[model samples]
Target chain A: MNFAFTEDQMAFRDAVRTLLEKECPPEVVRARWEGKPTEVWASLSDMGVVGMTAPEDAGGLGMDELDLVLVLEECGRAALPEPIVEHAAVVIPALREGGGKTAQRWLPMLAAGEAVATAGLGEAPLVPDADRAALLLDDHDGCLHAVEMSACELTPLDSIDRGRPLFAAAWYAEKDTKVEADFELAFDRAALGASAQLLGLADRMISMTVEHSKEREQFGRAIGSFQAVQHRLADALLRLEFARPVVYRAAYAVARPGECAPADRSLRVSMAKAYAGDAATDAARAALQIHGAIGYSWEFDLHLFMKRAWSLAAAYGDGSFHRRRVGDWLQQREDSDA
Target chain B: MDLTYSAPEAAFRAEARAWLDANVGPFRDASSNTADGFAKLREWDRLLFDARLSAVSWPEEYGGRGASLWEWLIFEEEYWAAAAPQRNSQNGIFLLAPTLFEFGTNEQRGRILPKMASGEEVWAQGWSEPNAGSDLAGLRSRAERVVEDGRGGWRLFGQKTWCSRGAFCDRLFGLFRSDPTAERHRGLTYLMVDLRAEGVEVRPVQVLDGEEGFAEVFFDGAFVPDQDVIGEPNDGWAVAMATASSERGLTLRSPGRFLATADRLVELWRARGDRSDPAVADSVVRAWMDAQAYQLFTQQAVSVLMAGEDKKMGAEASLNKVWWSELDLSIHEAALGLLGDEAQLDSDWLRGFEFALAGPIYAGTNEIQRNVIAQRLLGLPRG
Candidate 1:
């Protein structure tokens, strides 16, 4: 009956927030965007942010996806440039499912933050952080294979979200490759993780824009005081607020899949991805509109969150793709019922 | 966090479902806008009161089980899912009763709540004037003190337009100017007047659907005893704001109504056989998602209330009103979009579309809600 986070969950979230506040400030995020050798990954690894979702037998914290969702939101708020979500939420879960001699060899290293990984589970053509990842988890014939970066050829590409380096990786089966159990579930988890990130990014954009509106004056009054500006900001807040619970519910749906129908699970994930995608875009657009010209510039930190919003929104299944999936799922449910 | 009900809540839901299953029946007239339909709805309300299902969250003394907020939400879900008759006394139970509980004297609650819960006295809100639609502070209704035998009460005079359920309502609750020298929003008094009193008039106003769901109430010196005053004589603004919060918040628009609406829309979409069109499917899915969002958001708000966090309710109420109203509007629009011109022939969707049109406009328009969010929640400067 209760939807509020438990005391333990709140404390864990606060811990992640504190770590990101100290480790991934604007300068650090900028450095990561500039292709600098940043310590953000190692710092997060030290905080167990990289392996919180891995199983206990895999030498990780053995946390749930809800916990991972909490941490990912902080990563989004900080606009942290590391592949923590890829490493923890996607790769580790996929590797755990594809358990074997291959998982045993890499699971400890990946779970212990000894290496970083990127997942190519999305329908998007590009894989994020492929250039920086030591390991690549790619899809082949609807099954996942884990391979070393050296086993793949990556053609680098530019993304609007510079913090995430994108590449089209032609992946080949390597020594540690294995078929994963629950491949579809793994993909749903990835999209849901991205949804959580977008929720965080959207919320961050809202606060930053609100703060900007209060500080920025136009025609002898704060621009935020204007009804037009206020309404747009209100719309942004509305979308984000509504999108958030769906994202959390998606996380819950993923965490307890056995308790839910498969169609319901996928539908919930799609709902999260689609809603967060649209909401984050709206928040970013509203932030830009509220900031006027300064938000368009690279000098303001607002662009960092906005670009990340655009990148993450399209990275996982985009809104149109997920919405269609939802429609199809519900239609199937109706047919079965009939 | 767990979204499933606890054991007691589940039991309560089952009890309500069972009672409703046994006692509730479909409307013979299927329209609550007409006089006969209104009487039928009032009878149903009385039936629900007798079953102790009218206001589950209120105290036992006030004809309720004194259940928790979660239980009330559960009861609402079952109530709506069963397609039970609408609450005819909602104006009294949800809108006015919260204010009464918060500000009324013990005597006022003891006298007023039992009748309200039992549907013996149906109430209507009298907030808007001809000149005071969105800006309620500009209302010119006045209530002057009249003394007799060393005891004094107020004589109310002015017009209150857009009074929901005014035609059949037995009582009126509204704010009036108590001091001529005071400015807007100041020196106002919240009064409860008997609609049957002398010098009072109730004229029905036809809504867009050609239904007499609303009316304009005129008071040519309608008498309201001192006992009917909600709060201090000149501090009605704050009292009215309390009621306004209830009107805009969870009390008025429970998640159950939207859930039922969404479920119906899904059924309609399925029956329409347009799933092959990707655009159609996308619209249906979006509607379902919006309903889920609202349900979860309301649960979150209820959780906050259970935790005794009252400060966030006001802004959250405003956000909630905007969210549900827009969601309801879009769901109806999607239904019509699916049917196209056939929407004119289907009475269900047609009536739904008509009623939903008032969502954003009433309980303060969505525009005013945004202003509240921007200034109060976002801390944006007031324009």
Candidate 2:
């Protein structure tokens, strides 16, 4: 019956908020648009956020995705340019779930925040943050392979989200290359992780627009006083609020997989991802529209979160892709019932 | 965080589902809007009341099990999934009961609620007037203090329109302007009037569904005792807002009903669907997902409500109202779209579509809800 977060979870979330508020402002986010985010990334890694999900035995915090998802949302709120979601949410889970063989080799280094990994679980062709990744996990032909960035033949792919660099890697499962990982689980984790980030992004954009609408007046009154503008922002807020709990519940389901039914595991993540992605994208549109000419400018900070939303919606299982998965599962469930 | 129910909650849910499964079959006679159907549904209401399932969230003294919000939600999901007859006493149960719990005198609750649960006194709302539809503050209904028939009470004079279930209900609760000199939203009193009172007229009004589901209630010197006042005199607006927030959401249009509609829509699609059109399947799937979103959203709100007093729905009620209303229509629209040419027939989906049409208009129009969200929730300026 208790669907609320633990006090510890709220405390941790607040701690992340304080750290992000201090270290990762819009300037930090802007600087990383065409540059590496080494400063904030190292700060986060030092703060033990990079390896948050790795078990404590591996020299990490050993927090569940329930905790990690909250931290990831903070990262999105700050527009922190790091591939930690790929590393912690996708790759670490894949490594841990695949069991001892892969775990024994990479757990210590990854858990110690010394290595950063970016994953491409076949949802997108490009490996996010692959240019800076200490290791890259790619799913080619349904088999996952791991390789270091220095040894891999990879080309950077331009993304709308400039801070998060995507890459197309030329690699296959050769001897000593394959990592025993469940691709399906990695895919679900990626979508769910992206969903958490999108919630933060959407929330921030709406807050930004509301602030702007208050100050930026037209005809001797704030544009927000107009019902037309007010209603659009309200609709965007509705989308975000409704999508939020679905993401949290999905994180809960993903964090404790065995307890959830098999059908719920993937279906929940897909639903979260689809709802969150749509929320973020819609927020971006309304924010841009309400912010007027300033929002369209390159200098304004809204684009930082806006482009992140636009790009994230197309990556790691887009709304349409995740919805199709949901649709497929629903049809299967219905067929069984019949 | 735990989404799974406790053992007792699960047992409660199972008991409710089994009871509904066994009892709902004989009651699916007609739309509960018609006179014949209303009577039949009242019998069902008595069955539920006798079974202690009429108002699970109400206190045990009021014929309810005094269930937790979680258990109540679980019961609602099962209740609607069984396609049970609509709650014949909803105007009392949903709209007035919460207000009574919060502001009514102990005497008011003790006298009104038990009979309400038993369907012995059906209550209808008297909020809207021809002039005060969206602008409810513009209402001109007047109630003056007086001594009539050796009773110390107020005499009501004015009209209330769009009173749902007024045609058959036994009582009405509404606002009355008590001071002529006061402006709009001022000098009003929340009063409960007996529909059987002298100088009161209730003319049945036909809804778009061709049922006398609503009425135009005219009060020309109708007497209501001081005991019927819900809150302080001239503070009716605040008390009615409590009802608006509580009634327009969690208890009124619960996720259960829409979720059930989604399930039925899916079954219809399976019975006769266009396999080749991915777009059609996408529409159906989106409708289902939206319904799930509402369910999860309600679950989240329930968690907040259980945690603290300050985290009430408030303006979030507007967000919820707009969401479920639109989702209800979308689900029905998808079901009808699947039928194509055959959709025009007088089928359940068509009737549902007609009722769904009123969703955006009732319990405060969706437009008004948007304004509430903008002004109250978002702190936007009012022009």
* TM-score against truth, every candidate: 0.96, 0.97
Q: What tens digits encode model 1's per-residue C-alpha lDDT throughout B1-383? A: 87666688778878888998887875533456678888888788888889988888899998999888888888888877777766778889998999998999999999999898887889998999999988999989999999867778998888999988899899989999999789888999999999999979999999888989899999998888899999999999999999999988988888888887778888888887476787777777788789889998998888888888562377788999999999999889888888877877957777888889989899999999999998998999999
* DockQ for each numbered candidate: 0.83, 0.79
Residues forming the 10-long window of minimal summed lDDT in candidate 2 chain A: A329-338
lDDT of 2 by residue, A43-157 (tens): 7778788888887888779888899788888888887788878999988877776665567788778887788888877655777778777888888778777777777888877
Q: Report residue B375 deviation for candidate 2 (angstroms).
A: 1.9
**Cα lDDT, model 1, residue A296:** 88
lDDT of 2 at B183: 80
lDDT of 2 by residue, B1-383 (tens): 88777899878888998899888898975456777887777888888999999999999998999898888888888988888877779889998999999999999999999889888888989999989989999889899989777888898988999998788888999998998788887888999999999989999999998999899999998889889999998899999988998876788988888888898888887779885578888889899989999998899889989998753577889999999999999998999899999997888899899989999999999999999888888898897
What TM-score does chain A of model 2 get? 0.95
